[model samples]
Target chain A: MISQIAFVLVLAAAIYFIQKRFGRIRKNINLGKNRDFKDQVDKRLNNVLLVAFGQKKMFKRLIPAVLHLMIYVGFLVINLEVLEFMIDGFAGTHRIFAPFLGGFYTILMNVFEFLAIAVLVSCVFFLLRRNITKVPRFFNAEMKGWPRLDGNLILFTEIILMIAILTMNATDQLLQPISDHYPTTGELFFSSLLMPLFAGLNESTLIVIERFAWWFHIVGILGFTIYITYSKHLHIILAFPNTYFAKVEPKGHVNNMPVVTNEVKSMLGLVSAESSAPPTEPGRFGAKDINDLTWNNLLAAYTCTECGRCTSECPANITGKKLSPRKIMMDTRDRLEDVGNSLEKGGPGLNDGKSLLGDYITKEEINACTNCNACVEACPVLINPLEIITELRRYVAMEESGSPASWNSMYQNIETNFAPWKFSPSDRFNWAEEKK
Target chain B: MNIVTMAEFAAKGESPEILFWVGCAGSFDDRYKRVTRAFASILNSLDVKFAVLGTEETCTGDPARRAGNEFLFQMQAMNNIQVLNGYGIKKIVTACPHCFNTLKNEYPELGGNYEVIHHSTFLQQLIDSGRLKFEGGAYKGKKITYHDSCFLGRANDVYEAPRALLIALDADLIEMKRSRKTGLCCGAGGGQMFKEPENGKKDINVERTEEALETGASTIAVGCPFCMTMMSDGVKNKEREQDVKVKDIAELIAEAKGLS
Candidate 1:
């Protein structure tokens, strides 16, 4: 009964933590009206059947993929042991999987045990890889503290799990107490070889020891859950949801730009019937701030794994420009949070009620972008960096005539001359005559 | 009254010899003179009688359209379309991708719908049908890399037609790794042709031109007048004017026909 209570308690706790984390995600989104908000949830269901559960991106790097699969499946199998520990501990009979799992399960459990051991060993190698190669952002940055904690927790969980499995299998052999549900004489490879050591053991004493092993497994999993919720291991669960909402098609297409309403100074172009016409300004492009960016833009920032894949691919970054795609995402989050916090703390008098674009993000940073979708495309997870940057540009050029002098002249030319350079339209045929 | 596409225009009704809407780039820019001249020659070689829209041509306003200036683009597009309609010209061919894109794609929103073709595509059709023939070229040793104008490659899907023309003209086709749909900007889209590029690494065209040079090709071939000017400036900057050439596909065909 005590074991049953533990099972109920943990299941409730998992649900609770999951709900709490999701609430924060929802709160941020609902806080503001996003410009072009695509319904990500509906798309998510379609994506999973087509993309995620299909294991597409992981398999893109095929050589190491099989190993990742091994580790992934290992967690799933051990989860069965976790449930059984809870169930049997409540009923005072902890060998829940033995009878129904069958003679095949005898062999299956052995294989499951062996795989757990294999994955655990591989994870150690993964840990060492982190230490030796030490990828700058992924393994060594601010996220490092959580990974270090979670990595050891997973390692410990695996070690403790394997030990419990071995101990359970050895119960009959060592004459320790346990249920008869587990085949004592000859089961799978390990159990069969060791059963002889407990050949003379009686039933009741054996049952007692089995219950102890169940408790160890339950506690190990609970510890892992708490660690996972707070660590980089969080991606294990979060990546699925994040990937589901990932942008699939090109976001920079003229089709994808959100039509801004011309209400009280909105949008770069396309006036609503209600908006009053304003005089033309030229050479103005890009966003000035965080709110100036679209809601999808904020999602991109929040969803970024900070793996620096985008930073590596950026031409501007490679050429020693101040732009780092990784930092671009972080800075969006930081600036928004900073402003939000200040506002929350009642800091008065803001800068034009404008966004992170002109006020915080400089023209150079925005201009440095080629609007190439490379950074967006290269991301393993879907992050559309260009759209957010472009929207910011639209705000800068349209709202303020603070465009560069050349564009100022050019915009003037386009306005007066009807071409970007203000060249004479009469000259159109002059070219044909010159060829004569 | 003409709402037909190129394929339709090629198939049915009266064949239009000169749906000639001289684009603003062709009209205003001087280096583009060779562009319209070559186009005229290609039309003459095909024995197609065409009337020039002359002064009837105004800016198609693609620059204003893309720069988020809707009112100006609409004003310009409607004005040009009304002039073309006044000439009773249903089919139009342009040497400029900007005008072609604006009239074909964007003008409809402003109540102007007409078929427009870039000169490469129009010329390719003439060569394919055997009306226009470039028997051989006197030009030699110039390895050419074709730079795709954004209006042609991305806004429209006209990637291969120009390359096919270049191949038929016996020009060595060296490709920049980022050609076709992934083509680098000529630093001239989003109405940026008229404005200066924001302070960034190098000018987008210079970077793109470098990509052309990296292919070890001397002559950078282009389909649009805007690309012609930008790539020409890049070649001049690299001081490769003597060794490397920037020629429009029209200019290339002109050389092949010994007309220039």
Candidate 2:
């Protein structure tokens, strides 16, 4: 009864903390401008299946893909054990499905044990890839301390959790005969192998170890659920909705702002189609702050796994520019967090005088982007970093008129001559008249 | 060869089958002028009725819009749309991918809608219908690699038309390592063509050029005018200008037809 009470309290606290963090993130994302990505339901569903569940984009690099798939598929399948653990925790029942499932339960636990070991092995390799191996993608300028530590923490946490699970099962298998309420089980393949090691240990001592390991395994998962809200592993949950709502438009199509289009039409004396109201404020042009960007842009930032596939594929990054597409997403997410904290502390976000543009991401990085959409393509979960980059670039150009002199000249030339060159529009066809 | 303007067509109370949008680069850039002429020559030889906006033609404002000047882009687009709507133009074709992309995708939102086709697809259609016969002379048996323009390939999913045209030339059509959707930019999209590229280890065009060079094709076939300039510069950078000639799909087709 006491153990059940303790379990309920711990689960409640974990739920509270997780909900609070997600609530804050959702509010922050809602602070951005409105965008309608509501079309093409069937296509978005297919994209989620292909990209997120099937791990389609991850296979671009074969070794990592297989390793990741092992952890991904293993973690998913092994978490089924968590359902039984939850029932045991809540109802104070041990192996509730054991009687009905019988041999299948034993077989299932064996599969889960094998997968737990696979997950453990995969986590070690991931740690090595991040720490020991000099993979360039993992250690760029943006991944200084916290990002690196967070990655290691996730792997270490997974390793420890897997170990605790296996140890708990091993002790449970050893203690099942002595304990009255303990579920009767067949000789499990993996955990039973460790029976001889505990054969020398007495009954009371074995129960203590089993109970301790069981508590650690469940609590560790609960803690991980909360920690993931703070870690890059948030992608584990967010990747589903992110890939589901991923842009279904042609990759080359840039969405035109209907508000701005109407404004332009009004200026052109073409009847404003959607001009229902006059401008609210003069300062609105493009994204000067996070608020000016679309909510989908904010959501993309939140969904970033920080895997740096984007940075690896970025032409600007590879060519030695300041632009790292992964950094762009990270900075957006970081700024959103900052904004959310300020808002929660009872203040307007922009009133804090910190913006995503200058503070987190710089103009130089935004300018370096070729708008190639390689980052969008490379993302395993279909997060579009280019959307954020383009929005910031739009901010700089429109709000501050902060384009470089050459671009300004090009703009002026286009306005006057209808071309980037400083020639008359009437002379547009002079090339045909020229000697070929 | 007869070349008429929209104004002339309007004056005559007549309409052409297609409005050939001579994009800014094709109208003014010295290098791209040849591509325009080649495509025009093919259109004339096939007895296809097409009219140019000519002196009334302005830039499609692709560079302006991509450079982040939304106001200027709309200004130019609105002006062009007014002219096009006034002409009652329906089908449009252009050799430039920038023009093709903007006019097809972006213009509809601004109440400027028309069936815009890129010249690569148009040329392929002509060939498929036997409207343009390929005699296959100089390009016959030549090894040619095609460069996918970012706007045409990734933005529009047009991987086949240019390749189809190349196959019609009776030439061995080879592909670079990064072809189709995976194609690298020629370092000239999103207004990067006009501005000097930001400091980098190497220019993107130089990297893409090295990839094209690795294919070992004697001729590099291109669809977009911006790519034509970039790849030509890339070849020139490698000092392989003489050995590996960069030609537009239209130019290659015209050459095969012995139009020059």
Give the range where candidate 1 chain A is weakest over 10 consecutive residues by summed lDDT.
A255-264
Candidate 2 residue runs with Cα over 4 Å from true position: A194-197, A272-277, B135-141
Model 1 Cα lDDT, one tens digit per residue, B10-78: 445545565766566666767776577677776676667665665555667565445544444555655
lDDT of 1 at A400: 71
What is the fnat value (0 to 1) for candidate 2? 0.57
Model 1 RMSD to the real structure?
7.5
How much does each candidate deviate at the interface, measured as C-alpha RMSD after superposition? 5.8, 1.4
TM-scores for all candidates: the values are: 0.69, 0.95
- Residue-level lDDT tens digits of model 2 in A229-337: 7778898888888898788877777778666776777787777446646766645777767888888888888888799988987778887888899998898888888
**Residue A232 shift from truth in candidate 1, angstroms:** 8.9
Residues A74-157 of candidate 1 have per-residue lDDT tens digits of 776757665665566557563556667667656766776677666766666655655666644344233445436655666566
Best by lDDT: 2
